[model samples]
Target: MKVIKNIIFVAIVFLISIGLLVVGNGYDMYKDAISKIPLTEKVETIKEKENYTKIEEVPEIYIKAVISVEDHRFYKHNGIDIIAIGRATINDIKAMSFVEGGSTITQQLSKNIYFTQEKKITRKIAEVFMSLEIEKNYNKDEILELYLNTSYFGEGCYTVKEASRKYFGKEPKKMTDYEAIMLAGIPNAPSVYSLTKNPELAKQRQKQVINKMIEYKYLTQSEADKILEQ
Candidate 1:
Protein backbone atom coordinates (compact mmCIF):
# COMPACT_ATOMS: atom_id res chain seq x y z
CA MET A 1 0.00 0.00 0.00
CA LYS A 2 2.82 2.41 0.85
CA VAL A 3 4.60 1.70 -2.47
CA ILE A 4 1.34 2.12 -4.37
CA LYS A 5 0.72 5.49 -2.73
CA ASN A 6 4.26 6.63 -3.55
CA ILE A 7 3.82 5.61 -7.19
CA ILE A 8 0.51 7.43 -7.40
CA PHE A 9 2.04 10.52 -5.84
CA VAL A 10 4.89 10.54 -8.34
CA ALA A 11 2.46 10.04 -11.21
CA ILE A 12 0.31 12.93 -10.05
CA VAL A 13 3.32 15.21 -9.74
CA PHE A 14 4.56 14.19 -13.20
CA LEU A 15 1.18 14.84 -14.70
CA ILE A 16 1.02 18.28 -13.08
CA SER A 17 4.46 19.13 -14.41
CA ILE A 18 3.48 18.13 -17.95
CA GLY A 19 0.30 20.18 -17.74
CA LEU A 20 2.20 23.20 -16.51
CA LEU A 21 4.63 22.89 -19.37
CA VAL A 22 1.83 22.63 -21.90
CA VAL A 23 -0.03 25.63 -20.51
CA GLY A 24 3.16 27.67 -20.23
CA ASN A 25 4.20 27.00 -23.80
CA GLY A 26 0.62 27.47 -24.89
CA TYR A 27 0.53 30.93 -23.34
CA ASP A 28 3.66 31.89 -25.23
CA MET A 29 2.06 30.55 -28.38
CA TYR A 30 -1.02 32.64 -27.62
CA LYS A 31 1.11 35.75 -27.41
CA ASP A 32 2.68 34.97 -30.76
CA ALA A 33 -0.75 34.49 -32.26
CA ILE A 34 -1.91 37.83 -30.87
CA SER A 35 1.12 39.48 -32.36
CA LYS A 36 0.18 38.07 -35.73
CA ILE A 37 -3.36 39.46 -35.52
CA PRO A 38 -2.43 42.98 -36.52
CA LEU A 39 -0.23 41.69 -39.33
CA THR A 40 -3.05 39.60 -40.73
CA GLU A 41 -4.77 41.58 -43.44
CA LYS A 42 -8.45 41.91 -42.76
CA VAL A 43 -11.03 41.11 -45.41
CA GLU A 44 -12.53 44.57 -45.71
CA THR A 45 -15.60 43.40 -47.57
CA ILE A 46 -16.79 41.52 -44.51
CA LYS A 47 -16.82 44.66 -42.40
CA GLU A 48 -19.45 46.59 -44.31
CA LYS A 49 -22.42 46.03 -46.56
CA GLU A 50 -21.10 46.49 -50.05
CA ASN A 51 -23.61 47.23 -52.82
CA TYR A 52 -22.35 44.35 -54.98
CA THR A 53 -21.47 41.90 -52.18
CA LYS A 54 -23.65 38.85 -51.77
CA ILE A 55 -22.57 38.43 -48.12
CA GLU A 56 -24.28 41.65 -47.12
CA GLU A 57 -27.47 40.43 -48.77
CA VAL A 58 -27.28 36.83 -47.57
CA PRO A 59 -30.68 35.44 -46.62
CA GLU A 60 -32.00 34.31 -43.25
CA ILE A 61 -32.29 30.73 -44.45
CA TYR A 62 -28.58 30.63 -45.28
CA ILE A 63 -27.65 31.92 -41.84
CA LYS A 64 -29.98 29.47 -40.14
CA ALA A 65 -28.67 26.60 -42.19
CA VAL A 66 -25.07 27.41 -41.24
CA ILE A 67 -25.84 27.90 -37.55
CA SER A 68 -27.81 24.68 -37.46
CA VAL A 69 -25.08 22.66 -39.15
CA GLU A 70 -21.92 24.28 -37.76
CA ASP A 71 -22.87 25.46 -34.29
CA HIS A 72 -26.35 24.74 -33.00
CA ARG A 73 -25.57 26.83 -29.92
CA PHE A 74 -23.99 29.72 -31.80
CA TYR A 75 -26.26 32.21 -30.07
CA LYS A 76 -26.14 30.50 -26.66
CA HIS A 77 -22.46 30.22 -25.76
CA ASN A 78 -19.74 32.80 -25.47
CA GLY A 79 -16.71 32.34 -27.69
CA ILE A 80 -16.40 28.65 -26.96
CA ASP A 81 -18.97 25.95 -26.37
CA ILE A 82 -18.07 24.18 -23.13
CA ILE A 83 -20.40 21.26 -23.74
CA ALA A 84 -18.98 20.73 -27.20
CA ILE A 85 -15.42 21.12 -25.95
CA GLY A 86 -16.02 18.55 -23.25
CA ARG A 87 -17.61 16.16 -25.71
CA ALA A 88 -14.76 16.60 -28.15
CA THR A 89 -12.19 16.12 -25.38
CA ILE A 90 -13.69 12.81 -24.36
CA ASN A 91 -13.84 11.57 -27.92
CA ASP A 92 -10.26 12.67 -28.61
CA ILE A 93 -9.07 10.84 -25.50
CA LYS A 94 -10.96 7.71 -26.43
CA ALA A 95 -9.61 7.78 -29.93
CA MET A 96 -6.10 8.62 -28.74
CA SER A 97 -6.01 11.23 -31.46
CA PHE A 98 -7.25 14.72 -32.17
CA VAL A 99 -10.22 13.52 -34.14
CA GLU A 100 -12.84 15.96 -32.88
CA GLY A 101 -12.81 19.75 -32.63
CA GLY A 102 -15.33 22.13 -31.04
CA SER A 103 -14.52 25.23 -33.06
CA THR A 104 -17.26 27.81 -33.50
CA ILE A 105 -17.74 30.04 -36.53
CA THR A 106 -15.75 32.79 -34.85
CA GLN A 107 -12.94 30.38 -34.15
CA GLN A 108 -12.97 29.24 -37.74
CA LEU A 109 -12.83 32.86 -38.86
CA SER A 110 -9.95 33.46 -36.50
CA LYS A 111 -8.05 30.74 -38.27
CA ASN A 112 -9.13 31.93 -41.65
CA ILE A 113 -7.89 35.44 -41.11
CA TYR A 114 -5.30 35.33 -38.35
CA PHE A 115 -3.82 31.87 -38.27
CA THR A 116 -2.60 29.15 -40.55
CA GLN A 117 -4.04 25.65 -40.91
CA GLU A 118 -1.30 24.04 -38.87
CA LYS A 119 -2.81 21.31 -36.72
CA LYS A 120 -1.03 21.75 -33.43
CA ILE A 121 -1.89 22.08 -29.76
CA THR A 122 -0.46 25.59 -29.72
CA ARG A 123 -2.50 26.59 -32.76
CA LYS A 124 -5.67 25.29 -31.14
CA ILE A 125 -4.92 27.22 -27.95
CA ALA A 126 -4.26 30.36 -29.97
CA GLU A 127 -7.54 29.88 -31.81
CA VAL A 128 -9.39 29.88 -28.47
CA PHE A 129 -7.95 33.29 -27.58
CA MET A 130 -8.57 34.68 -31.06
CA SER A 131 -12.15 33.45 -30.91
CA LEU A 132 -12.69 35.22 -27.60
CA GLU A 133 -11.24 38.39 -29.07
CA ILE A 134 -13.53 38.08 -32.11
CA GLU A 135 -16.61 37.64 -29.93
CA LYS A 136 -15.60 40.67 -27.88
CA ASN A 137 -15.18 42.80 -30.99
CA TYR A 138 -17.96 41.58 -33.28
CA ASN A 139 -21.54 40.44 -33.05
CA LYS A 140 -22.83 37.01 -34.08
CA ASP A 141 -24.17 38.33 -37.35
CA GLU A 142 -20.87 39.91 -38.18
CA ILE A 143 -19.00 36.72 -37.45
CA LEU A 144 -21.36 34.63 -39.56
CA GLU A 145 -21.22 37.11 -42.38
CA LEU A 146 -17.45 37.19 -42.30
CA TYR A 147 -17.28 33.41 -42.26
CA LEU A 148 -19.67 33.14 -45.18
CA ASN A 149 -17.84 35.76 -47.14
CA THR A 150 -14.33 34.41 -46.50
CA SER A 151 -14.60 30.66 -46.09
CA TYR A 152 -13.45 28.34 -48.85
CA PHE A 153 -15.80 26.04 -50.72
CA GLY A 154 -13.12 24.27 -52.78
CA GLU A 155 -12.69 24.35 -56.58
CA GLY A 156 -11.33 27.87 -56.30
CA CYS A 157 -14.43 28.99 -54.44
CA TYR A 158 -13.53 31.68 -51.94
CA THR A 159 -16.89 33.06 -50.84
CA VAL A 160 -20.55 32.14 -50.52
CA LYS A 161 -21.36 34.23 -53.56
CA GLU A 162 -18.61 32.58 -55.52
CA ALA A 163 -19.79 29.15 -54.48
CA SER A 164 -23.36 30.01 -55.43
CA ARG A 165 -22.32 31.27 -58.83
CA LYS A 166 -20.13 28.22 -59.35
CA TYR A 167 -22.87 25.74 -58.53
CA PHE A 168 -26.07 27.46 -59.57
CA GLY A 169 -25.01 30.68 -61.36
CA LYS A 170 -27.39 32.69 -59.14
CA GLU A 171 -27.10 35.14 -56.29
CA PRO A 172 -27.31 33.85 -52.72
CA LYS A 173 -30.75 35.30 -51.96
CA LYS A 174 -32.24 33.57 -54.97
CA MET A 175 -30.93 30.15 -53.98
CA THR A 176 -33.39 27.58 -52.64
CA ASP A 177 -33.08 26.10 -49.15
CA TYR A 178 -31.60 23.00 -50.71
CA GLU A 179 -28.85 25.06 -52.31
CA ALA A 180 -28.25 27.01 -49.12
CA ILE A 181 -27.87 23.82 -47.09
CA MET A 182 -25.51 22.36 -49.67
CA LEU A 183 -23.28 25.44 -49.51
CA ALA A 184 -23.41 25.32 -45.70
CA GLY A 185 -21.85 21.87 -45.74
CA ILE A 186 -18.87 22.73 -47.93
CA PRO A 187 -16.69 24.62 -45.46
CA ASN A 188 -16.34 21.59 -43.19
CA ALA A 189 -13.88 19.94 -45.62
CA PRO A 190 -13.76 21.93 -48.77
CA SER A 191 -11.33 19.58 -50.46
CA VAL A 192 -13.43 16.53 -49.84
CA TYR A 193 -16.90 18.02 -49.94
CA SER A 194 -16.95 20.78 -52.53
CA LEU A 195 -19.96 20.57 -54.79
CA THR A 196 -17.75 20.20 -57.85
CA LYS A 197 -14.82 18.25 -56.44
CA ASN A 198 -16.56 15.42 -54.67
CA PRO A 199 -20.21 16.05 -55.19
CA GLU A 200 -21.34 12.78 -53.64
CA LEU A 201 -19.72 13.69 -50.34
CA ALA A 202 -21.14 17.19 -50.60
CA LYS A 203 -24.64 15.81 -51.06
CA GLN A 204 -24.19 13.47 -48.09
CA ARG A 205 -23.05 16.39 -45.96
CA GLN A 206 -26.03 18.46 -47.12
CA LYS A 207 -28.35 15.75 -45.82
CA GLN A 208 -26.58 15.91 -42.48
CA VAL A 209 -27.07 19.67 -42.39
CA ILE A 210 -30.81 19.36 -43.03
CA ASN A 211 -31.07 16.65 -40.39
CA LYS A 212 -29.35 18.94 -37.91
CA MET A 213 -31.80 21.71 -38.76
CA ILE A 214 -34.64 19.35 -38.00
CA GLU A 215 -33.06 18.26 -34.73
CA TYR A 216 -32.62 21.90 -33.73
CA LYS A 217 -36.32 22.46 -34.42
CA TYR A 218 -35.53 24.96 -37.13
CA LEU A 219 -37.25 22.64 -39.55
CA THR A 220 -39.63 19.69 -39.41
CA GLN A 221 -38.97 16.29 -40.97
CA SER A 222 -41.32 17.14 -43.82
CA GLU A 223 -39.51 20.38 -44.41
CA ALA A 224 -36.11 18.71 -44.34
CA ASP A 225 -37.30 15.98 -46.70
CA LYS A 226 -38.80 18.51 -49.04
CA ILE A 227 -35.53 20.42 -49.17
CA LEU A 228 -33.55 17.20 -49.59
CA GLU A 229 -35.77 16.01 -52.41
CA GLN A 230 -35.34 19.25 -54.31
Candidate 2:
Protein backbone atom coordinates (compact mmCIF):
# COMPACT_ATOMS: atom_id res chain seq x y z
CA MET A 1 0.00 0.00 0.00
CA LYS A 2 2.88 2.39 0.75
CA VAL A 3 4.52 1.56 -2.57
CA ILE A 4 1.27 2.24 -4.40
CA LYS A 5 0.89 5.59 -2.61
CA ASN A 6 4.44 6.54 -3.57
CA ILE A 7 3.77 5.67 -7.17
CA ILE A 8 0.62 7.79 -7.20
CA PHE A 9 2.41 10.75 -5.67
CA VAL A 10 5.21 10.46 -8.21
CA ALA A 11 2.72 10.31 -11.05
CA ILE A 12 0.95 13.43 -9.82
CA VAL A 13 4.23 15.30 -9.57
CA PHE A 14 5.22 14.20 -13.04
CA LEU A 15 1.96 15.39 -14.48
CA ILE A 16 2.27 18.75 -12.72
CA SER A 17 5.81 19.15 -14.08
CA ILE A 18 4.66 18.41 -17.60
CA GLY A 19 1.87 20.96 -17.25
CA LEU A 20 4.27 23.64 -16.03
CA LEU A 21 6.68 22.94 -18.88
CA VAL A 22 3.90 23.19 -21.40
CA VAL A 23 2.70 26.48 -19.95
CA GLY A 24 6.15 28.10 -19.76
CA ASN A 25 8.16 26.66 -22.63
CA GLY A 26 5.42 25.65 -25.00
CA TYR A 27 4.56 29.24 -26.02
CA ASP A 28 8.14 30.02 -26.98
CA MET A 29 8.34 26.83 -28.95
CA TYR A 30 5.16 27.78 -30.80
CA LYS A 31 6.13 31.43 -31.31
CA ASP A 32 9.40 30.28 -32.82
CA ALA A 33 7.38 28.21 -35.24
CA ILE A 34 5.42 31.33 -36.32
CA SER A 35 8.53 33.44 -36.83
CA LYS A 36 10.45 30.69 -38.57
CA ILE A 37 7.68 29.73 -40.97
CA PRO A 38 5.70 32.90 -41.39
CA LEU A 39 2.39 32.46 -43.14
CA THR A 40 3.57 34.28 -46.25
CA GLU A 41 6.55 31.96 -46.70
CA LYS A 42 4.48 28.89 -46.05
CA VAL A 43 1.92 29.85 -48.69
CA GLU A 44 4.59 30.82 -51.24
CA THR A 45 6.66 27.71 -50.71
CA ILE A 46 3.81 25.26 -50.44
CA LYS A 47 1.86 26.56 -53.43
CA GLU A 48 4.95 27.68 -55.37
CA LYS A 49 2.95 30.73 -56.27
CA GLU A 50 1.76 34.25 -55.47
CA ASN A 51 3.07 36.57 -52.82
CA TYR A 52 0.90 37.27 -49.74
CA THR A 53 0.16 40.59 -48.10
CA LYS A 54 -0.28 41.06 -44.36
CA ILE A 55 -3.73 40.93 -42.78
CA GLU A 56 -3.74 44.56 -41.68
CA GLU A 57 -3.46 45.69 -45.30
CA VAL A 58 -6.45 43.67 -46.40
CA PRO A 59 -9.94 45.16 -46.75
CA GLU A 60 -12.40 45.02 -43.84
CA ILE A 61 -15.23 43.77 -45.97
CA TYR A 62 -13.38 40.62 -46.84
CA ILE A 63 -12.66 39.95 -43.21
CA LYS A 64 -16.28 40.56 -42.31
CA ALA A 65 -17.50 38.29 -45.04
CA VAL A 66 -15.22 35.49 -43.95
CA ILE A 67 -16.17 35.76 -40.31
CA SER A 68 -19.84 36.03 -41.18
CA VAL A 69 -19.71 32.80 -43.11
CA GLU A 70 -17.03 30.65 -41.52
CA ASP A 71 -17.56 31.60 -37.89
CA HIS A 72 -20.64 33.58 -37.02
CA ARG A 73 -19.82 33.71 -33.33
CA PHE A 74 -16.18 34.48 -33.93
CA TYR A 75 -16.24 37.77 -32.07
CA LYS A 76 -18.51 36.52 -29.32
CA HIS A 77 -16.54 33.40 -28.37
CA ASN A 78 -13.28 33.38 -26.50
CA GLY A 79 -10.90 30.81 -27.97
CA ILE A 80 -13.30 27.96 -28.34
CA ASP A 81 -17.08 27.69 -28.71
CA ILE A 82 -18.49 25.06 -26.43
CA ILE A 83 -21.52 24.56 -28.66
CA ALA A 84 -19.42 24.05 -31.74
CA ILE A 85 -17.15 21.66 -29.89
CA GLY A 86 -20.10 19.64 -28.63
CA ARG A 87 -21.59 19.45 -32.11
CA ALA A 88 -18.28 18.34 -33.55
CA THR A 89 -17.92 15.71 -30.83
CA ILE A 90 -21.33 14.32 -31.60
CA ASN A 91 -20.63 14.25 -35.31
CA ASP A 92 -17.26 12.58 -34.81
CA ILE A 93 -18.86 9.93 -32.60
CA LYS A 94 -21.55 9.30 -35.16
CA ALA A 95 -19.09 9.07 -38.01
CA MET A 96 -16.58 7.03 -36.01
CA SER A 97 -13.87 9.05 -37.66
CA PHE A 98 -12.18 12.43 -37.41
CA VAL A 99 -14.81 13.88 -39.66
CA GLU A 100 -15.54 16.98 -37.63
CA GLY A 101 -13.35 19.69 -36.15
CA GLY A 102 -14.94 22.20 -33.78
CA SER A 103 -12.01 24.58 -33.87
CA THR A 104 -12.96 28.23 -33.66
CA ILE A 105 -11.18 30.76 -35.87
CA THR A 106 -8.82 31.38 -32.98
CA GLN A 107 -8.03 27.69 -32.72
CA GLN A 108 -7.46 27.49 -36.46
CA LEU A 109 -5.11 30.46 -36.23
CA SER A 110 -3.30 28.82 -33.32
CA LYS A 111 -2.77 25.64 -35.29
CA ASN A 112 -1.65 27.52 -38.37
CA ILE A 113 0.74 29.75 -36.48
CA TYR A 114 2.26 27.18 -34.14
CA PHE A 115 2.06 23.73 -35.69
CA THR A 116 2.54 21.77 -38.86
CA GLN A 117 -0.12 20.22 -41.05
CA GLU A 118 0.08 16.96 -39.14
CA LYS A 119 -3.21 15.98 -37.46
CA LYS A 120 -2.04 14.43 -34.24
CA ILE A 121 -3.43 14.62 -30.69
CA THR A 122 -0.39 16.45 -29.32
CA ARG A 123 -0.65 19.09 -32.05
CA LYS A 124 -4.33 19.51 -31.25
CA ILE A 125 -3.68 20.00 -27.52
CA ALA A 126 -1.01 22.57 -28.33
CA GLU A 127 -3.43 24.30 -30.66
CA VAL A 128 -6.06 24.51 -27.94
CA PHE A 129 -3.59 25.92 -25.44
CA MET A 130 -2.22 28.45 -27.88
CA SER A 131 -5.71 29.47 -28.91
CA LEU A 132 -6.62 30.19 -25.32
CA GLU A 133 -3.45 32.22 -24.99
CA ILE A 134 -4.29 34.17 -28.11
CA GLU A 135 -7.76 34.91 -26.80
CA LYS A 136 -6.35 36.15 -23.56
CA ASN A 137 -3.80 38.35 -25.29
CA TYR A 138 -5.57 39.64 -28.41
CA ASN A 139 -8.93 41.07 -29.33
CA LYS A 140 -11.51 39.32 -31.47
CA ASP A 141 -11.02 41.62 -34.43
CA GLU A 142 -7.29 41.07 -34.31
CA ILE A 143 -7.69 37.31 -34.31
CA LEU A 144 -10.19 37.42 -37.17
CA GLU A 145 -7.98 39.70 -39.21
CA LEU A 146 -4.95 37.51 -38.66
CA TYR A 147 -6.84 34.39 -39.67
CA LEU A 148 -8.18 36.04 -42.82
CA ASN A 149 -4.80 37.23 -43.90
CA THR A 150 -2.87 34.05 -43.13
CA SER A 151 -5.29 31.26 -43.92
CA TYR A 152 -4.80 29.17 -47.06
CA PHE A 153 -7.42 29.15 -49.78
CA GLY A 154 -7.41 26.90 -52.84
CA GLU A 155 -5.31 27.63 -55.96
CA GLY A 156 -2.28 28.91 -54.10
CA CYS A 157 -3.80 32.09 -52.81
CA TYR A 158 -2.70 33.12 -49.32
CA THR A 159 -4.90 36.05 -48.30
CA VAL A 160 -8.53 36.72 -49.12
CA LYS A 161 -7.53 39.60 -51.38
CA GLU A 162 -5.15 37.33 -53.27
CA ALA A 163 -7.85 34.71 -53.57
CA SER A 164 -10.30 37.30 -54.86
CA ARG A 165 -7.85 38.33 -57.54
CA LYS A 166 -6.99 34.76 -58.46
CA TYR A 167 -10.58 33.64 -58.73
CA PHE A 168 -12.58 36.69 -59.80
CA GLY A 169 -9.82 39.00 -60.99
CA LYS A 170 -11.06 41.63 -58.56
CA GLU A 171 -10.27 42.89 -55.11
CA PRO A 172 -11.98 41.21 -52.17
CA LYS A 173 -13.86 44.42 -51.40
CA LYS A 174 -15.37 44.19 -54.86
CA MET A 175 -16.46 40.58 -54.51
CA THR A 176 -20.12 39.85 -55.30
CA ASP A 177 -22.27 37.47 -53.29
CA TYR A 178 -21.49 34.46 -55.43
CA GLU A 179 -17.82 35.30 -55.50
CA ALA A 180 -17.73 35.64 -51.73
CA ILE A 181 -19.50 32.33 -51.24
CA MET A 182 -17.18 30.59 -53.66
CA LEU A 183 -14.12 31.91 -51.87
CA ALA A 184 -15.54 30.98 -48.49
CA GLY A 185 -16.21 27.40 -49.60
CA ILE A 186 -12.73 26.65 -50.86
CA PRO A 187 -10.95 26.72 -47.49
CA ASN A 188 -12.59 23.52 -46.28
CA ALA A 189 -11.18 21.39 -49.12
CA PRO A 190 -9.06 23.54 -51.34
CA SER A 191 -7.87 20.89 -53.76
CA VAL A 192 -11.25 19.27 -54.14
CA TYR A 193 -13.36 22.43 -54.36
CA SER A 194 -11.03 24.55 -56.44
CA LEU A 195 -13.01 26.75 -58.83
CA THR A 196 -10.56 26.26 -61.65
CA LYS A 197 -10.46 22.50 -61.29
CA ASN A 198 -13.85 21.50 -59.87
CA PRO A 199 -16.49 24.01 -60.77
CA GLU A 200 -19.35 21.70 -59.86
CA LEU A 201 -18.12 20.97 -56.37
CA ALA A 202 -17.27 24.59 -55.89
CA LYS A 203 -20.79 25.52 -56.89
CA GLN A 204 -22.21 23.01 -54.47
CA ARG A 205 -20.13 24.39 -51.63
CA GLN A 206 -21.05 27.91 -52.63
CA LYS A 207 -24.69 26.94 -52.37
CA GLN A 208 -24.04 25.50 -48.97
CA VAL A 209 -22.44 28.76 -47.82
CA ILE A 210 -25.35 30.73 -49.21
CA ASN A 211 -27.74 28.51 -47.31
CA LYS A 212 -25.76 29.03 -44.14
CA MET A 213 -25.73 32.77 -44.67
CA ILE A 214 -29.47 32.74 -45.08
CA GLU A 215 -29.86 30.65 -41.98
CA TYR A 216 -27.65 33.04 -40.05
CA LYS A 217 -29.61 36.07 -41.32
CA TYR A 218 -26.63 37.44 -43.20
CA LEU A 219 -28.67 36.99 -46.34
CA THR A 220 -32.35 36.76 -46.93
CA GLN A 221 -33.87 33.62 -48.40
CA SER A 222 -34.71 35.54 -51.55
CA GLU A 223 -31.14 36.73 -51.84
CA ALA A 224 -29.88 33.21 -51.28
CA ASP A 225 -32.23 31.83 -53.89
CA LYS A 226 -31.13 34.47 -56.35
CA ILE A 227 -27.46 33.69 -55.75
CA LEU A 228 -28.16 29.97 -56.06
CA GLU A 229 -29.99 30.50 -59.33
CA GLN A 230 -27.02 32.38 -60.68
TM-score on alpha carbons, each prediction: 0.89, 0.74
Give the C-alpha lDDT of model 1: 0.80
TM-score of 2: 0.74
Please give the RMSD to the true structure for each candidate, in Å: 2.5, 5.4
Off by over 4 Å in 2: 1-65
Cα lDDT tens digits, model 2, 1-230, are: 99999999999999998877766565565566657775455534534434444555555434545666677788788888889888988998899887878888888887766677676545666677778877887788667766766678877676787888898898776777667777877887889898899999988887777767767777788867786676
Report the lDDT tens digits of candidate 1 across residue range 76-173.
Answer: 87779889889989999999998988888877888887778887777777788878877887788767777887788887776777778889999888
Model 1 vs. true fold: TM: 0.89
Displacement of residue 200 (Cα, Å) in model 2 is 0.7
Global lDDT of each candidate:
0.80, 0.73
Top candidate, metric TM-score: 1
lDDT of 2 at 73: 87
